[model samples]
Target chain A: MLTVEKVSKEIDGKKIVNHVSFQIKQGECVGIIGPNGAGKSTIVSLISGLEKPTGGEISLSNRPISSWGVKKLAQQMAVLTQDGLNPYPISVFDAVLMGRYPHLSFFQREGKKDYDKVEEVLETVGLTDLKDQMLDTLSGGERQRVAIAKAMVQEPSLLILDEPTTFLDIGYQLNILSIVKDWQRKDDLTILMVLHDLNLAAQFCDRLILMDEGEIVKIGSSEEILQEDLLSKVYHTKPEIVRHPKWDIPQILLHYE
Target chain B: MSKKLFQRDRMLWLWIPIFLIILLIVMSVSVSLGAASVDWKTVWKIVFSKIPYVGDWVTADWSDSAETIIWDIRFPRVVLGAIVGAALALAGAIYQGVLRNPLADPYILGVSSGASFGAALVIVFGWQLFGVGRFTLPAVAFIFGFTTLMIVYLLARVQNKVRLETIILAGVVVQAFIGACLSLILALSNEQLQTIIFWMMGSLSLTDWSYTAVVFPIVIVGAILSLFFIKDINMLGLGEEVAHHSGVSVQRTRFLLLILASVITGAAVSVSGAIGFVGLVVPHIIRLLFGSNYRMILPLSIIGGAIFLVGADAVARTILAPRELPLGIITAFLGAPFFGYLLRRAKREYF
Candidate 1:
């Protein structure tokens, strides 16, 4: 449902996203993995229409992303960044209810249906007990969960997660991704997430797009993309790859030389 | 779960009536406790007697001087104070919300400085706006204030996005430049120096019925327009990106809000001069007492601001009795230390 055709974003004189092209069908979760400065976030920004590409076009369901109204596009997609939300001292429920902005007209306060959506999403994110809790007082994990709950309430068919697990602990990381997993399954959601952890990327994503130096290195299933040779070439670090004991997906292991 | 939600909504409902009562009481007290010391019963009787049909019923047992003091003088001054207070507070809330900075205010945005500069020009040159007479000063002030906001907003925009830090910096620099020009005007002046100085210090004492008539509709209309965007302002507290992700047109919303806030502030400053802290401090107090929700903060700030300024004006005129202090001085004395305390205790985010 999403396509990027030779999209290139130039900042100053340097190319942040250099002629990158990829597509994700409906109901698929694709992971983009790379080292720092690989322009994964820029690609997400372009697709989300937060920033325009200088060179090429990005389209959602065959319509140019720029052609869609911001609110119209928002009703179809939601983007979450690594830093999550600012610590505004808003109640968790109110923060989540903000997701209904696109659905309601101007001067229309959130009615019963919108409130119900927020309540349901808060329950799903296990934050029902903390509905009255202020966002700034929450832990990093909890705040990200609030962000996720907010995104869920947006009810977007396409979800963009831009390195969402960067500051999270391993446990919270798994919890967040699992929540997204369940959400995708239930809603038939399509996800484009940038992941720093290659092992988690292989485990959660059906397809991986490995990138290097603002260019797409390869795109394939986890088995094909997570090969040690390809990863070492892109990341400039030698690592061992082993299959998971249960799921049999390729997992990366690193050791001090 | 639904019951809890219902309870929260109901709780919010109770505050409106509560604040309205407080506002009414405070206004009444402010109107009564001026230099002449009118009694509460006399105050109400005089106030009620001014109402159209009610005036027919209320016996005019009170002296004409007392009626003049209540109706012609204190009543309009107090009402003007409420209008200016509400405008400043509403503008402050919008600035803080849109800029995503707690320190943001109309003063921070150069709106007040620009208005003051325009007023100073009128005072120095004695411009009557080509026979427009009494309103010429405020009209020129409004034009300058609105223009200054546009300039500051444009200066801060980079790559189609307005960074909070950049906008604050832009406003401060613009304010400094305007302040310098105003100082130059002050230095070159002869007879109008005291008028300019006292006007800069801000006072509600000079206000009459005409001033209220000029400012009332502008603030009321700006406030009504602001209601449409309070939710958008709330979304902005999550930052522009998240607000955009949730479908708020951040740039357009920011522009409209800035214009609306500046227009309201321009009107208030035109009539009241640069009353500091009413805008900056009132919204913070509301957020501290209530919550960071703009839906509540915007409306509550209106009442809270009116009460704060009216009360401050009362204290200004009556604190030294015969020798009245400037309203701005009163506000700073009360608002600065309280704001400092808020800052010191602000370990929890109030934004």
Candidate 2:
């Protein structure tokens, strides 16, 4: 559904995202895993057209992303960046309604269909009860759910999430990932996410791409890529890779400093 | 639960009447209490005489000095005050939304300084460069103000994206440069020193029908232009990239808003000569009362700002009676304490 061909981004004089190329098939959930400053977020920004790649081409479905007008592109794909916190006292419902902006023409009033979609997304994110509550008054996990509901209301074919669960507790983190996984299965949506937790990526993602120092070092399925030496080499730290006793998924045990 | 719902409904109904009464009382008191101490009865009589068929009952004689004073002098001044105030406040709200910064005001983008420089140049040179006949100084001021913003805008644009931080910095730098040039002109001028000083200090002494005519149309146009962009402005309050992804043409929208706001500020400053604090305080108050929805906030800011400014001007003119105080001084005096209170309150609430 999405393809990146030789994408490179340089800032100031230093290379930030270097010669990265990858593709995700239709209905696939791909997780990009890397340590901090590994161009994971940069890759997402480039694909979303938030920043122009210094050198490369990105295509959605088959058309180059540049050829898609902003509104059309927004209809095709939705993005949720890390800094989604709005300072205003917007309600969860109104915040989610913002996702329908691209679908609206200037001076057009939102109809019942828009409200229905918002309601559906709110229910999906388990935020129906908190719909009227001010976003500033919500807890971190609730706010994140509100953000997710907002992206869901876009109803895009492709969803890009950048470290969405970073601020949530472990339970909420698992809940969010599980929600995304359920959506992937139910809607057959194409999702590309940047995740710091390799184990979660291994368990949930259909494919994983490992990046380090602005370069994609490896890309494969969990069983093929989640080796002990590969994790150690990419992260520059020793880690023990063990198999899940029941599910047989690869899990990592990191060595402390 | 039923009782609670009833109470909530009652409160909602109660709010409209209470606010309306406050607005009415403020407007009436502001009109009647300026400079010359006219009795409430006399003020009412003058007001009634202006009405179509009721003039016979209110006017005992054809030549009523009180009617003329109320209608001619104080009334127009009050109206002008309202329009200028509302224009400044609405511009402020729009600027804050476009920049996505709560602290931004209408004058923060160097528009006001640009206006001052324009007015000062016309005053110091005593030349009508635009050849606009009698409407020379103000026309020149508007031209310079609009041109300066265009230049600042062009300077800040990078690859078609205007950075908010860069624009702000550019505003500050240009403001300082223009201020220096203004000061140099003032230092060199030997004859019109006091006139220049008075103009810079800001006064509504030029409250005439012609001045009103020039200012009102521009202000109304600016306000209308701003109203159309209310949704785009709301999206902009989120951030530029998000707004762009949401189908807003961020750069083009921002440029239009800035130009409109600058024109509003220039027209207002040309007439009133830099009345400080109304733009900054009025919009903040409106935002606090209503939510951050620009659709409601922009209109409210215009009305609320006008009321606030008219009320301030009334106080300025009446307090000293025969001797008029500058509008800027009164605004600064009133606005500083209110601003302090707001800051303290915001800190307590947010922190």
Candidate 3:
């Protein structure tokens, strides 16, 4: 569904993403994992077309990124970013309804169809009780769920998650991923998630793309990419890779020097 | 249970329309109280006569001077007040949403202080460019106000990209510089100083149909442009990425809306001096009752602002009788306290 060919992005004399290329197949769950400043978010931003690549090309379904005006591109993909939601006080329903904005024309308000979709989404996300409550009143976990529900309501082919579980507790981290995992299965949703926790990435993603210094270090199934030597070398940290006893997925364990 | 409450909420929506009608009634009452002391019935007769089908039903018994007084003199000022009020409030609401800051006002772009300088120059020097005479001050005021906005906008831009915080900060800096210059100008000029000082305080006292005629089209056109982007503006509070992901052209919407909002504020300040408090308070006040939805906030604030300012102008005219209080004083005094009360009561509901 998406392709990046030697895509590079530079800003103010610094190469944030350099000579990186990857293809994401339809219905595949992919994770981009890297240490801080490994250009994880920037790469996500580039793929989302929120930021333009300084060189090379990114194409969605065979069309170049530049050709997709923001409105058209938005209908094709939804993004959940780590950046704080604006602190403007708004109700949960109103926040979720905003996801339907791209679908509505200029000056056209959300109609019965839009509200019906929002009601179903709120129920799916377990926020029906809090629908009328202000978003500012929501807990971190609830806010993240609301954000996810917002993305879900977009009904896009591609869903991008940037640090989807950052600032969340372990319990919430598991919960958010489970929701994503379920939706990916249900909708055949193509997810490109940026995860900081290597273990979570290994557990949830079908494949992992390990990155370092604005370049891709490895791209393969989690079992292949989460190898101890490659992760330790790329992350500059000693690490141990273990398999889940039942699930048999690769999980990374960091060690103190 | 919540669905029941939602239905009740639908019932409560009638309150805004009813309140708007009350505002119209108050405006009618206000025209009667100012200077001439005409009765409400007489005022309505003149008002009704101007309407197409209603003219024959209107008694047409009112005097010619009374007709001129109500229709020509007082009616225009009230309508201008409503226009200025609506313009300022909508500008405030848009600024607050785009900047994602509740405290942001239309004057955050330095329009007020810039207009002050222009009005000050006219009052102090007694110079009327192009022999425009009295219109010179407002024309210069609009030009200077617009220029300040452009300067702030430019300073906030880096490589042709503008950040919301940068522009707001730039406006603060420009306001301070222009404010100092204005004070210096006021201090140096001794005669006709009250004219400048009082105008700085802002008044609708100078309003006439010509002022209203010139400003109405500009404000209405600006308002129409703003309305076209209502959906985009509603998404702005989600922040740039989320708004963009929702299909809003963030930077473009912000740029166009900023210009549109500036048009409302600059044109308003040009005609009405620099009324404050109404823009900042009216939107917040409306949001308390209506929730933070821009759909509700936009129209409610426009009407609510018109009501508030015209109400304030009414009190400004009749509170002391014969001599008028500056419109800003009444707005700040009345609006700020009312807003404080609403804020205290609805702290959790503020959107």
Candidate 4:
């Protein structure tokens, strides 16, 4: 479980994340949805300890996040930011192996245990065949899967992905979301992800947090938070919520200007 | 059935020949062929005499003058060239990794200009302010070089993160300012002007066994230290956020790398007087061959860089015969065209 209490972040006297508070329970897949510049990424950064909050505390598993060393924090939580794309031509295996960095010591090589774990993660992410392939050769979808594999290799309690499917195609997006959902169910992993697609978030996420201009407007189950009126109010656009015939999930339809 | 094993086996085989051929060609031709036209036999004699037990068989027919020329003069210069080359390349690789910019060189921190100014000050005043025994000029150069780099690094660092553009701009500005200072010293100095001028132009002529003795340990230590940080450097190449998430102290690692690289650049410049392009070119060539893996690239750069500068030095010595060209000039001449070709190739490939 992760709890963020009254977290606020300011840069040069301008508030980026303002008085944001949220709690994520164990095994819950929470989605943060907002338009561009809505401070969704900022919240992820704060949660991942990339940026410190000006006012408030974040705790994981009832312990203060600040008490955790970087490696300890990494062991508990793995974050894959939108800019996780590496320009270097590294092999996929090596790229995923980087996730084990926090677990390994400076002088230690990747031992049998490390390689075994990596092999397991490669299989989990469906990238076992592409392990030896160069990252540059992989497609955008394959790259995101590789990123997810990297995070999974950490075996963290919480997985935080900021805009993981922003550049991916619909099939790839579904593939990633399904994979996350499957992992959440099987491993009981806590996931907090940012998504631009309201429909995808509504379908895949157990809970949804709606944010607008650095503040969370609402947080609840997708059915409660994905109301047409609330989304219209938050996004300043008309959105229709329809029931999914099979899954009983809310489906969102946005009306363009 | 064993296709996967075959692929892995082939990959290993591919690198072995490529690495060995380049290593061999660069080492043999660079060391054996030189300006003095000394036969391979004499060169062997001179080299073997330095070995404790094997001296007699090789040096039986060698004269004292020949031995002195080979052992004291040419040998030290070659060794210094190799050390400086390795240092420069190592520094270049680190800077590129830290900045995530392929074009970044060791001079990005303004160490070269700082060392040059230090040398200028020593040459003009003929005084060693640092009080370093024996090798005062180089010691002074190193001190100023390291100082200038620290200053530049500090100026470039804003809110802890060192912005690539800021570092590059600071380096250029500080370099210009130091160049003016050097000019001022040149204008004021009356005595030892010729020596000052020659040194400023950059030379390997001043190299001796004593200079080599002083720099060898520092370069070796710096190179070895860099090798240990290859993994950290690899992480850094991915950018600060990724590195941090991977549990690397990004800022501290970057700072240490910069200082170590500066020490290398300073030490090399102190002895070789700002020999350019070896740092810029050698690492690029190594990367082209070895891929971007720092684990392989760093060690290969050390050996490859040594071979490169030794070859360049040999060419510099032999090409002009009796009239020796400055080693800096030779490197620049070779480096500029190679740099242009690389730039064109990179543009075509990446842009």
The whole-model lDDT of each prediction reads 0.88, 0.79, 0.85, 0.79
Q: TM-score-based ranking, best first? A: 1, 3, 4, 2
Candidate 3 — which residues are off by over 4 angstroms? A254-257, B1-15, B125-134, B347-351
Q: What is the TM-score of chain A alone in each candidate?
A: 0.99, 0.97, 0.97, 0.95
Which model, 1 or 3, shows the larger TM-score?
Answer: 1
lDDT of 3 by residue, B162-232 (tens): 99889999999999999999989988988878988889888988667889988999988887777677678
The true-versus-predicted C-alpha distance at residue B318 of model 3, in Å, is 1.8
Error of 1 at A123 (Å): 1.4
What tens digits encode model 1's per-residue C-alpha lDDT throughout A3-51?
A: 9999999989999999999999999999999999999988888888888
| Candidate closer to the true structure by DockQ (higher is better), 3 or 4 | 3
Off by over 4 Å in 1: B1-9, B341-347
Which candidate wins on DockQ?
1
State the weakest 10-residue window (summed lDDT) of model 4 chain A.
A82-91
Task: Report the C-alpha lDDT of model 2 over B1-351, residue by residue, as the tens digit.
Answer: 101111111243454455456655666688778545676666667777778998877645434676677788777777788778888898888888887766788788777777777777777778765567767777877777777788788888888888999998888787788889888888898887777777776777767667888899999988887877876887787667667666677788888888888889889888877788888888876565455667656777887778778778877877888778888888888887986776665532221
Give the top-scoring candidate (lDDT). 1
Which has the higher TM-score value, candidate number 2 or candidate number 4? 4
Clashing residue pairs in candidate 4 (N, C-alpha, C atoms within 3 angstroms):
B35-B318
Best by TM-score: 1
Decreasing DockQ order of the candidates? 1, 3, 4, 2
Report the candidate with higher DockQ, 1 versus 2: 1
**Per-model B-chain TM-score:** 0.94, 0.87, 0.93, 0.87
lDDT of 3 by residue, A108-185 (tens): 867899889999988887899998777777788888888888888888999999997898999988988898888888
